[model samples]
Target: MSDILFSLPVEQQITPCLTLCKKDELPVIVINHPKAKGAISLQGAHVLSWQPEGEKPVLWLSPESNFKQGVAIRGGIPICWPWFGKAGDPMHGFARNQLWQLIAHDENDECVWLTFSLEDNEQTRILWPHSFSLIARIKMGETCEIELESHGDYSFTSALHTYLNIGDIDQISVSGLGPNYLDKVVGGEHTTADKKLTFSGLIDRIYTQPESFSVIADPANQRSIEIHHKNASDAVAWNPGAEVAKGMADMPDDGYKTMVCVETAYVTNARTVTNDKPQFLSATIRCHKNEQK
Candidate 1:
């Protein structure tokens, strides 16, 4: 890998080619390099875009997503931590609403390594009283690798809420999920999927004891995506479908047709972590434009 340099925004002044910018007033770090390109918002340390060389976007972003402060964008790899879903106030927790610090970054011809950290504050303590540190380390290249670590004493459900884009939801199938899942669409009814998951209705299921790698086949786009993860036993597959997409103020009526959520998570009675034990999760996503089989 060749050594590369990028210029950062005058205010951020981090490095070369890695610039700091704003989108509709939200602070973001824009990475424009030879091997990778993407944008990461400091607010939540959330990845908004990651389009590697010679491939389509692996992440799905809602077109109508609001980039305002305190407003979580409707897509991308949302770090659903401390608690998942509506278990706590402010919807998916305040982590997405708060800003994080860029702790480290290194670049080469192959990829760029970035680490961001978010620690407990008065505001977070007010919501869920606990002192903790959340670190998100991302490596961008042909394959986007993300690792999340929680350093504290706590037991909470979490997920790397990832949204995968598809040419057509009806023509896609997610393989490698657990055989059994708790169907959220049918009020947490336990069920089993016969084969690869195909979207037809409002599908929201938490697949427990899942495999390490899942394949998302997008026949309409003539490509498939590989989602591999570690340090987790669960996966969440969500598609709002037609009927339920009607009431979402953040999502358009037809938005669900373009994207699906296949998150690597730990939602089912996540193991407790104390000062003696630190919790962590890692995942890597690779996109390939192979002809659909």
Candidate 2:
């Protein structure tokens, strides 16, 4: 872990709330606001952690995550753009593996907002031949909000792959994803979702036209997490289980027991972005006491 501090254009505005530091040689922005605390890495513009005051962490991050360049950090929220998953060689697009510029930032009594931007370069064009500008705006406060916008003249599949923290995988239930989905673990077999989804083993399904919001009820933690999304045509639910997680070097074998991914996405159906009509995908997360339990 490197301890070198870097200077930002908005260094003065960042005082009393944010700091620019290096972690494992990658530039990171550490947030310490009155309402919340979090960290965002410039590499991929990935959000590594977030916790509202007086509450448990809302996101999950792998302890063994690599903080080096050109590698995807295993946790928090990863921005997958242009192409998602095996649509390209890098698995989940180049957006999350590239360094993004912090174009702007602001602070208010209730929230702190940071805007990061990435555009096509020779390296990115080599991976996917297209001209584009991507902007990720993050707001941290009592509630966490992330919005991704694309300006280009091309169609693409993307997702905000969010890994949520939970008390225990077995003690939680996720609801609001409608009845149908494509089961990826079964090689894309279509399946139906139960009223409330529970985890027992490897589960990977994509709900093409899910409801706009999903709630994770965690009785053991005495809280429920609500994920409200906008302009997303699909919702992805995933958990690798013990056997599959064992093969991953970044995540512990039992990591799946405490986390779940309910991603907001534009998969299965790609969205076309143009200069005249930019595309936007956003998700807002809030945690509340589990009143039912």
Number of the top lDDT candidate: 2
After superposition on all C-alphas, the RMSD of every candidate to the true structure, in Å, is: 3.9, 3.3
Error of 2 at 177 (Å): 0.9
lDDT per residue, candidate 1, 97-192, as tens digits? 889999999998898899999999998999999899989998888888889888888788888898887899989999999788988767764757
Off by over 4 Å in 2: 1-13, 189-193, 291-293
Model 1 spans > 4 angstroms off: 1-13, 291-293
Q: After superposition, how far is residue 125 of candidate 2 from its true place, in Å?
A: 0.7
TM-score of each: 0.93, 0.94
lDDT of 1: 0.83
Worst 10 residues of 2 by lDDT: 1-10
Best by TM-score: 2
lDDT of each: 0.83, 0.88
